[model samples]
Target: MNIILKNIKHISVNEGITINKLEQIIGASKGVLSRAIAKNTDIQTKWLVNIVKNYPQYSCEWLIKNEGEMIKPTGEIFLTKENIEETAINYKDLAESRKETIDSMKKEIMYLEEKIENLKKQNELL
Candidate 1:
């Protein structure tokens, strides 16, 4: 089998799902991948991208080029108490920072939009 089909099979087995379920996860038709495998042609880029997006735990390099492991190294989760505490703190800090940034951006956008509206009115007056 081609690397593409092999990767798909690997993912299905790892995820404990069938080929049909894999198709569902990748948002593709049931027979599309099978046909591609039978023809031994390259799978389309869009399909590959969709699959990667849905299953970010899988290494894209491995999926397309067979260059790395199926599951990304960073995809592993550490559930130690220290790790959990650190993650919780980091998440809270990130959320607060993001909220502040988003609020500032909204204000800046509103200011720019008002300035644009004023410029439009001035042009109309001219």
Candidate 2:
């Protein structure tokens, strides 16, 4: 079930950043964040993730639970383009490996099924 976000005012005030900068950091805009907070709008998980990731100092619980201090000054979340590209390449390689494994497993399953069917037919003849 989706829960409406609370304590947005507290978060904004504690962060000490203008709405625009906050939006930029989270890859959103002033209007979207403002509407969400002011109207008690449903916050998507993706948006929430972006916020928590970009501002690591901000308490994740505070962002989701609204039950604690807003900003905790945690680690940096910035990623360079090169880092992203490398990560993407790594993921592609992993996906290819997974696909190959799945294909092999499927073939093995088909072979086993065929053997089972043949054994059942032979037993019935006996």
Candidate 3:
């Protein structure tokens, strides 16, 4: 696994937060967030700063290199109303995105299923 993915996964697991939710809270798209989390790529400092600033619960060391715990030792996760409101708006946007992605994926799956069924039919005919 890429270091970014590993870090992202570790943070998500440790902090009890999803990548999508985090991305939403930070006002980044899912694709951008996914790319940023990849170890092979260099994540811009500004974006990383934005994420940490928005959610202090995330540890900089952990988010950067997957070395430390996602949460700080003190465990004082900031949950201010402003942060909540920002996160809430992102969640609202994510809700629609979630539905869209699911529908698209479902369509792709159906297409693959049809292709498999046709292949099976061809095999039976052979």
Best by TM-score: 3
Residue lDDT tens for model 2, 1-126: 223255545544555554554555567855777677667668667877776655455677666666566665445435567546644654564566567768999999999999999999999999
* Reference-based lDDT, each prediction: 0.72, 0.62, 0.70
Best lDDT among the predictions, by candidate number: 1
Would you give me the overall lDDT of model 1?
0.72
Tens-place lDDT digits, model 3, residues 1-126: 666556766655554557776676566777666665654566566667877777576778777777777677764666788878866765575576678878999999999999999999999999
- As for lDDT, the candidate ahead, 1 or 2, is 1
Clashing pairs in 1: none
Q: Order the candidates by lDDT, highest first.
A: 1, 3, 2
Those runs of model 2 whose alpha carbons end farther than 4 Å from true positions after fitting are: 1-6, 68-126
Model 1: worst 10 consecutive residues (lDDT sum): 86-95
